[model samples]
Target chain A: MFAGLSAFPLTPLRNDEVDEVAYAGLIERLVAAGVDSITALGSTGAYPYLTTDERRRVARVALEHAGSVPVVVGVGALRTSQVIGLARDAADAGASGVLLAPMSYQPLTDDDVFGLYEDVAAAVPLPVIVYDNPGTTHFEFSDALYARIAQLPNIASIKIPGVPAEPDAARARVEQIRSAVSDRVTIGISGDASAARGLNAGCDTWYSVIGGTLPEAALAICRAARSGDAAAAMAESDRLQPLWDLFAEHGGSFRVIAAIAELGGLVTPNSLPLPVRGLDRTARDRVARVVRELGLIPPA
Target chain B: MFAGLSAFPLTPLRNDEVDEVAYAGLIERLVAAGVDSITALGSTGAYPYLTTDERRRVARVALEHAGSVPVVVGVGALRTSQVIGLARDAADAGASGVLLAPMSYQPLTDDDVFGLYEDVAAAVPLPVIVYDNPGTTHFEFSDALYARIAQLPNIASIKIPGVPAEPDAARARVEQIRSAVSDRVTIGISGDASAARGLNAGCDTWYSVIGGTLPEAALAICRAARSGDAAAAMAESDRLQPLWDLFAEHGGSFRVIAAIAELGGLVTPNSLPLPVRGLDRTARDRVARVVRELGLIPPA
Candidate 1:
């Protein structure tokens, strides 16, 4: 179920509202490029900013566009009840699975952590994928906790943040996790810039944020990686690295999504929530130059 | 509106439900102890874990118990709609003001940051205090951004996290922000342990997490400080340093909250979220010893 590329699409907002037409176009482009599965309302999708109604609308639009492709909905909320409610909504909306993060408020104890997963898993009939993005949630699931959570039948996979620049250390940690949960769950590496090392670490699924912005390029890399073509995967990663770096240089995940949305001409007057600054003229020029060099789009 | 010790009381949970009885008792204690104000549903109160109904119930309880004491309710949410709705609820529930953190999702742009305050301020008639707890949000509102947001009429105060020991640079940053917005906004320092330094640096309010667990001791220290009794304030702080150290020694804010909650006998089986391991026995013993030494609680 988790063998190929999963594109976590960025939600398109136009003038403070969800632009369904642009969202459908983004989804259609990803599906055409051979994305195996799609995730909506993830970090890139600005899931937190979305109201319950907006989340349902986006999920429905994504599902309509996916048609046959499996669509996983991001269902993280600070409260377990809200998350469970969203999970039910996602399932009702015809989602194949839900990407759940631990409760983001209080730091959860191991028991609390496991309980959170159990609550969500029990609340929905669809399979669940644990998303460990400490960068946003400020909580990282340890290997032991993951191992324990993996024993739950409903948890189908995990999306681990891609390893840092140190490939070997990242590979080792992934290997340890793989060894512990190999029988129970699939492992997907996020942070597309380091997807190559993740594959080397034995991860089979690649969750791509870039895929949301550049579906063809993202799919090509995933396809190359799946076929055991390390060189091509690395080449694709190298080409995409500039965009990733641009996101990092600006700030982190949200800025990157906003930048991508601006680039796609899908959202205008794009903005992030408080505390995150937007791309400046310098950052915009850098992204434009990279896009031009990569032949992804015409120069701005 | 901005002076003395402010207590961010814990939201009591009984049988996995909101314990309004216990919460009201806690608020009564803070108010009786001469706490300048009480903040309901802050991070210390586990606001993020509470359902909207639970949050409203707790806010109601705090307001009822507060009587004439000003109760500032925390109203930050990942979604703008949720925040607006919560702010309205808080105002309707009779909270004196709303303490808001920038939306916690991806980092926010200056426009997004200002927009959040402007929208929240406009949505509720009550005064608003801009909360800047970067430790949890992983995003810092720049002095420039804070300056702009502070210009809004309802934006009455700023809660900056206390200076970390390292990056001695934060002291200067705090001063710079104070310089820009001090006239328009009163600055509140978050960490009780850092209150002495923060006060010296021009912070007018000491918003206390530790105060929730040790109301009398915290108030004594605040009163001492307000009256220019630095020696007494330092002495009380010295007594509390080990507990603060326990928080710093482990996971910053998460560990501190969990430790204090355990000590106060508020929540049994207290635990933090993932990535943050709970205090080990050794750390727990140290905290216990400090609590005892400071006469923070009676001997068992």
Candidate 2:
């Protein structure tokens, strides 16, 4: 359950509330597509934007709908006490494991981050995934910090950001972190664009953003690598270059993924939380055209 | 009311709850010291660490105890709806203005950030202070973004981070921003170590961190600068170089300020939000030695 493709789904919203039905639909889609794991309340899920009650409900929905696929809930907060509380909630809701990001407002010291993982480890019995998404959390992890934290009990995995573009560089980077943590801790690659490259570099899992929405496409790439066909995996990823380009041009995957969900009718229009407007008409139209051209959406 | 020294007091906590009596005492002390205004939920106030209800209670306590001092509330949240809601609460509590930072979970685009201020401006009636605290919020506003936001109606002030150390460069930085906004928008400076320099460089206000706990020392530097005594202001700031050194050595002012508040009997021991630990015993003893030598604390 700790390895292979882990899909990160958006917890869609409607009228300023979590659209539980829509969110469960997202999870069921991932489960049906056969992702090895489903991570609810990921950065894609807008965990920080939600209230405690909303998070609890979202966790329960994911657990109920995910069926055999292991559910990993993101339990991150600014305060240590809050993170611990969220971790307990996740455990109570039957989460298989908890993904913990050292979410920060005060720029956290390495010690502060270590203290966070330490406290969570002491309090929660579930496996902990050390979430290292600096793009959102703004706290970069040192290999030393990863090494230190990976030694803690139940530190199940480390979700690293994108690998370097070049093949050798990506492998070396993965190996560097690999040398730091023990073999029991799986290495999962995020940064949807670099998924193929990271997998070929021997990463055990793709903690994928795109996997949540287009699981069939994501699994095509994931399965190719697992079958030892590295070239096929890269070829599959290249096929989705348009989507990766959109992610780069925009700030991140959240809005772009939301745009796709709306176009596919998987989620309602205006499904994003307030203050995050959808892509402007021109960019959105470009996405529709590209998805159709790529056969990701049926042409009219 | 947006100019001069605006003290940012910590909303002291005890046993994981807001210590309202202690919080009121901190506000009253700032009032007695005659700061130009009181910002109840600045980064110093641990605004992001608190809940909406805790923030509301703190705002009311600040208003009730501040007498006639203008109170500006920090209404920052990760989601746009949450920020606007906090702003509405601030307005309902009679805050003179609201300070807003682009609090982020997913890295925000410039457009995303602009839309946030736009939504808040349209939704809330209070004067808006554009809080540019990158150390905490992790979002940097380009000068163009600042100019763009300043054009919004009800945008009252811009709280810039700090000026360059060189006098000429500092003045140029201030002048660069001044040329963009109309005079109706005041320019406030944060970064406590640089406040005197910023004031000397003609910044209209000092949005201070240290001022929340040590008003007299901050006011000395601020008053000297306002009285056309730039040299004295520099000297006053220089006299507190030891404290500045401590701030420089530590991560930021939050822990050090918590230590000061605790040592001076303003709040209970370990009043900071959890996961954020106080300084080590050695560092704390050093702080105590410096304070006693500087007469910040009476001998004991």
Candidate 3:
């Protein structure tokens, strides 16, 4: 079960290979910041873009540096058997659990989606986190479907992405899911700008994007919200507003977050996969101003 | 460039490994049927679901038995660098060319789409086919975007999946693209039942699903259509109606085609990737009747 801020680590690359040194450094910082959990290979981590070999390596490296915190490896794929294979590998690599999304080229029936999770969960002893990211998967789970999936054994958590423009609606959706599922199941929320709203609505964990690179700030927001200190939570959310605005203006948070990590010297400046590009010069400069204003970059 | 009926061979599996013997036989049949081109690792061929090594093997096996016909290997992936790498491998494996779709998790801008094709086309020495399949990729190319992409060096063809229920609309869309691009680029249409309409509307090729397993029937339809024999073309189409109706109902043709290939004893009754399932018992019975009626199944 997860609580507080679950950091989705940004994948650091050097010379076209995953930079283990930089990646470990990022994880160590999150651990030091007392981030509740580390979800490796999340959307920000470019799980779909990596090769199977690369994914295995990333999962292994993440668990190695996670220390006491659980490392949830993203194991989503086009095939159920492939997802099962990844789950086996993740368990063998000592991952805490596997996060699965029903990803497919063809439109999948509700039964097909349920079958994918059931088969994978049955194959591995590890816990499963159902990832509902409609933006990437183009497969949305209705509340009824979510409630149904929550009944499967070993399905430990559900990460629901918050709707960007509607905080109240997003919070209400989380509460609805929360009311439907068992208390044993952990329900978390993703969407950097809306994480506080999700927390206020009683989602137990913040599956965050900016939190992957800016853990201290994310933990502060989580701590404030969890303690019912709305003013403090709003201050942290307001401080992060500039970056969130940039992410909203662009398509999503992946590129802008990577840009901030690079600018802050958290990880080496790296190229994202083709078509999902980083911020333009103007946007990068804006990101730099926000990073400086928030004191994210260490003193030279 | 491609012309006439092009076969997209199904990837057969035996104990989760690519069945080399079954695959080779499938390719040999296409060559014998005088298919103008062979497209390996297509949607029906399950390209995205396969591993990198499996995809390379599929392409090599395809080229090996393609004989006199050109073999176009699908090289699309979620990453640009990955696509370039696959294109390089396709060329190395003696493939005639590569087909690419702007596959991504992020919603790409028009400029991003153009850039992906440009970079991949620049990296390889083979002709590139721009695949515009919105059903799978969810990335639609505006006609202006298609015209721009067609202008890129080494881009030889465009595979446009037909608008199934509307032939006139599909034909008009094809004409718009045809008028926008130079004559050097060949425009082909996919969707088995609509192939006759596409050809009648000036599409140069039938990029087929049934053609992969039952090449003789697909070729007969194409031949009749190309020779201005409307009655013969319609007759062929009407005969194939049961199968085409299945494809339209299923949302995409991959599963139905895979089902037909299995029912006809084409490739040892292969397993398609998860979520892309074959027909149910009732649908399978319908497919069996169609296969028997059309004499697609070879004699024991």
Q: In DockQ terms, which candidate is top?
A: 3
> Candidates 1 and 2: which is better by TM-score?
2
Question: For each of the candidates, what fraction of the native contacts does it recover?
Answer: 0.39, 0.66, 0.77
| CAPRI quality band, candidate 2 | medium
Q: Write the per-residue lDDT of candidate 3 for residues A1-300, one digit (tens) a residue.
A: 478888998887765678888888888888888898899998888888888888898889888998998888999988777888888889988988888988868778787898888888788998899999988888878888888888989988999887444557866777678788877889888888888777877788899887788887898999999998866886788887877888888888888888888887777776576666666789889888878887776321
Candidate 3 per-residue lDDT, tens place, B212-248, comes to 8888889888999889886688788888787777788
Estimated TM-score for each candidate: 0.85, 0.96, 0.93
* Candidate 1 DockQ vs. native: 0.34
Higher-ranked by lDDT: 1 or 2:
2
Model 1 regions lying over 4 Å from their true place: A108-112, A164-176, A262-289, A298-300, B109-115, B122-125, B141-149, B163-178, B196-202, B249-300
The best-first sequence of candidates by DockQ reads 3, 2, 1
Record all residue pairs in model 3 with backbone atoms less than 3 Å apart, i.e. clashing.
none
After superposing candidate 3 on the true structure, give the runs of residues whose Cα lies further than 4 Å from its correct spot: A163-172, A290-300, B163-172, B230-235, B290-300
> What is the per-residue lDDT of model 1 for residues B1-300, given as tens digits with 9 covering 90 to 100?
667788887675654677676667778777877788999988878776666777888899899989788999998887666788899999899888998887465656667678778888887898899888876666677778888888888888988887654324645766788788848678888866687666545567888886676778878777777787766776777777776776676645556555656666655543332223457777777777777777776211
Residue A257 local lDDT, model 3: 82
Model 1 chain B weakest lDDT span, ten residues long: B268-277
